[model samples]
Target: MDLANLHFQNPEAFFLLLLGPLLILDWWWHAHKRKSTIKFPALAIAKKAAKGSKVRARYIVPALRMAALCCFVVALARPQNATEVEYTSTDGVDIMLALDVSGSMGTLDMLTRTDQAKLGVMNAEKVLKSGRFWDYSRLGYAKNVMAEFVQKRESDRIGLSVFAGNSYTLVPLTLDYGALLEILQAVDDSSASGNGTAIGDGLMNSLARLEKSDAKSKVVVLLTDGIDNASLVPPLHAAEVAKALGVKVYTIGVGKKSGTFLAFQQNPWTGEISWGEQPIPAENSLDEKTLSQIASSTGGRFYRAESKDDLEKIYSEIDGLEKTEIQTIAYARYQEKFYPWLLVGALLILLELVLANTRFVRIP
Candidate 1:
């Protein structure tokens, strides 16, 4: 009865519907043309009494026949119910997030519990350093943004590599994002023992994780705040190896080195908060030249993020660059729906015949 998605299998059969109306016109013409002779008195009372229920119902037989003819035409058309369905298949990409957790990551640039953007500037060079701003530090913002990036990679296999003076893998390339997030959150800055920034070692460590990958496209996203100082393997050499293996390495230099920044600390026992200034030295500035060379050598881009928002946008850009195009296939399934119409047509025809012979038969 819901014809919204209905269809016909044998549509040409509907041509038979022309017969019903033709039969009706023929019945009307013959009823008018046929002549009958019967002698009877012309009485008004008799004419009024003749218009009884049974007399009126004499036309019901022909109406039933016409309705039956319509049903037959519909039955022949072979109506059906069809529903369409579709599915998508994606050629997935593989990615690795190379993070820098050097001692410099503890230097606060503006990320705080209150999301203050210019915290360091407002309280510039107060000259005190506090280790209590753990969640509002550079490392914390990187981890939070990286977690969001992971969520956007629908079917890609992603891994994590962390480095400072030493580099190592925290999670292998896997599709289980839940397990990866658990380990990523538990990591600390340089294990509190690392001394220098080993940028080359970080890239090489990430490349090693992607060495055996068979994905159509492979990528490494590396972020660091300080210059490379203690890597056994040089950064350019690692970039050559990545290029040879058909892997792209995107590098990000985080934090602003324009002026002095303020660092804050809270007294653990008294719960009092205090702030002081910290200046950026030329030696500890981000090694943008080497990082840029690494990215270009591997056919990737380099980005500079001076704030949390900039870093998020950089990650978003990389995510957009490596996304896989999803292709969908569609088809339809049909179910036969003509049986009820056929059955109704047959029942109507039978009822018409029975009524014509038993209650409205003509003596011809």
Candidate 2:
């Protein structure tokens, strides 16, 4: 017999301990208690009768009871042997990247101010600030950073959203990073005609997109520069909706009112031209307080980005934060062990009864 197969939850085997003392006590009590006395006219007749009959039957009740108890005790310990098995499955993460494409996003924070145009700006500051030129559009910065973030997660399903005065889906939730990047790269400030920021609408759109996902983990990355200005739905209400559906939203506030570069453009085809590069002032200062509250309400974090570098670092951190759905399988296998013990107990009890009534039986 395999020792492992004879497992007991109570390792002390308490039933065995009780049975030993009980059997011994029962045997001793019976031995001293039962006595046969004869009032005989002749002593010789009584002696002759005692020699013909057995003094007492030994070992029947105690032996049978001990055997029965042992079998029953062993059965109480549920035991099973392990068997190896194989398992296979697949799962991934779902993420939505909601970006603000409002016109104010053309704020320029990249490259050192140079030439006579950069004059009056501190020269020592310019000398210290020489860096690579980056496109000065909120959409452009978001596209580049999100591209990098998505590239690192091959197993995750990604989607895109552009929210301005209104919101619209640029890409539905999908695993095709190629298509997502293309849509994100093509995004321009012209996508939104209204000058307002619909931050709440954007979050609501992302939440609606994830409603059917059924993914183990769902997330929304909302990047915006303004408050709930043009949105019909309020940011807090949208967050409550997300909480109801068990989705986490990470909010990124882009652009600061002071010292960030801003670029203007001309529609050459319409012959309408706009001039000058200025520091982009927040139409409404980036709502860090509201954004932080949104993140906190849903077990997420808020990040503030005033420069392209800050945006890049934020994306790297968010990439690290995104988690994949996990799946697990459990099983229970039981072996029927009680029947054998019950059968043995019944037979032992029956044998005890029969020996008491038959072989060792006496006439009244």
Candidate 3:
């Protein structure tokens, strides 16, 4: 039975002051209205008539009226019981998304299956001619899948990073999923300003962004295909930094078993054509083994994303993995019922008026 009240401040003691003035005014007015008494004949007959009447003997009527007024005033005070509850809210993970925008990610290799290639004998012939090729490059596929992933996670605070030859924080950790998707959709292969990959730098940049987050869990989802070809700090060292800061790093390897060729065009002289071909060995391209080791060292898992669907599934899994607990406190506010107290005062004044005009009437 906890007692509390609602007002501009504590108001439980205010009622005592309110009724005091009225009681004093009533007592003073009644004490001053005394008149001289006159001898009356047939007093015995009057006393006999009063004996049979059932009217109140004392001030029962006024006392009953005061009791009713007290009830209404207490009700207006708005008493409430205060309590505290503890519950877990599983939605409080803060994440930083480090995306690989390296030049090699532009290599086209992901293939899409269509119904046109599922028909009959003609379909079989077309399928044979369809050669295994991807319509979009790895970077483009990543953009599409990440856009969807950001839209699905509106409750969590997320940040974005783009790394290639150099690393930069494009969007700091935020809960604005729409803005994050807008940035994702706007990303193009041209955004890979650096010609090389800096996986270590990217991881370090992500950790820096998450430094200010005071959450129960902090994590980084680092997606890269190329090894750290250009970085002052090594990828393994960056992973160690993340571990020291209590940040988990989930590594994603995006590409195929056998990496594809990265294509480029160069023009020399006005309108002169200069086309060349070079095979970037798939083995030296993306260092998945190192990435897996980094993730394992930081109590996180590594995932492989070879296509758009694979990328989406990887993000879905990450979304389910990171979570937080939020506890919300709810209670009703108390309001002062001074208006009802004043109303009762008005009723009492009105009752006094009626009594003076009829039952308690006196001849001036």
Candidate 4:
């Protein structure tokens, strides 16, 4: 029981407290009016003797009785301790993140961060020296950004699906963001061993997960850097299926217009080889028209991400567009505290009776 939350259940019973003062006043008035006559002269000696004796101590009995009466009245008021409980009912959205892990994701075009302050990546020279090869790739940047995005959603149920020449659902819709990010971070270019991009299969797999969802708002955020080259299902047919299922699909294309490619050469006489980066026109095999059509068909948007910052901004925009709904209810539970007060009042009254009869008794 919390003493701080104590309150009276029946406050009207407190009117009994007025009886204590009235009883004290009546005792005082009677004692004052009833006076005895003395026939002896020089009464100063008798008054001095009475003043120095223990006669005044007898008033303790009445004081104890008054205190016991106050306790009994408070106990009758029925004090209680109140405890509050709060519960939330969330109507959250179900989201599926479809990622492309084709071999083209290994390109170093938008992966190398010149401004360390922006993406918080290690220096290019350090990454090369440390043999952390994937740190300078598109897949690495995408995984980092997606992990951060997952942390921002609190109430939403998120799922993951990765694809290359084929598609696989890495996780089902769940509220466990930690486990989902763990699986996402472990994904690399080797995750999809096949050599071609299967955009249709990816979307179909994502839709398969969303199809089972009972959420009011179902969505898919599909990201890719290549055109569909190997898929059993057609991209347009997949979009039609998404529309029929009432699922929105947001598509994001990642890459720059112009980027660098690694060129390698071998010394014929010395039998040595060296590799250097060469400037090349970026190959954007990404089918932007089809991606836009898919997005439009499902009442979603299409975004182009040329840099890491652009990708982050696109994800942030999507996060803002899909908001979760939550409702909270609060109530209190009260426990009866009158039992302890009743026991204490009874003990006090009993103690007063015992002391009055023995140590502080008076003659009638």
Positional deviation of residue 105's Cα in model 2 after best superposition, in angstroms: 1.3
Off by over 4 Å in 3: 1-92, 114-135, 259-285, 359-364
Task: Put down candidate 4 lDDT per residue, 1-364, tens digits, no spaces.
Answer: 2245787878888898888889899978987887776575768876676442456776776787787788788788888888889999888899999999997876666744463333243344444445354655677778889898999999999999999999999999999999999999899767775779999999999999999799989999999998888889988899999999999999999876566744334568975544456574545457899999999999999999877888899999999999888899998878888887778778878887897888766554
Local distance difference test, candidate 1: 0.83
Worst 10 residues of 2 by lDDT: 125-134
Q: What is candidate 3's lDDT per residue for 1-364, written digit by digit as tens?
A: 2344333233464365478459657955884676666677988876676542224422433553565566555555544433445544555678888888876675655534441232221332333235211225677677777777677764678889988888888889888887888887666545657678888999999999887778778999998877888876899999999999899999998877664443333454564322233454655456878899889999999998777789888888887777555566565444445566566656776775676566655555
In candidate 2, position 253 carries an lDDT of 89
lDDT of each: 0.83, 0.74, 0.70, 0.82
Per-candidate TM-scores read 0.77, 0.56, 0.65, 0.83
Clashes of each: 6, 4, 3, 0
Clashing pairs in 1: 125-277, 126-276, 126-277, 127-276, 127-277, 128-276
Tally clashing residue pairs in candidate 4.
0
- Candidate that beats the other on lDDT, 2 or 3, i.e. the better one: 2
RMSD values for the candidates in order, in angstroms, are: 5.1, 13.0, 8.9, 4.3
> How high is the lDDT of residue 190 in model 4?
70
Q: Output the TM-score of candidate 2.
A: 0.56
Clashing residue pairs for model 3 = 6-334, 89-326, 92-324
TM-score of 3: 0.65
Model 1 regions lying over 4 Å from their true place: 1-3, 25-52, 110-132, 153-155, 174-179, 190-195, 212-216, 230-232, 263-274
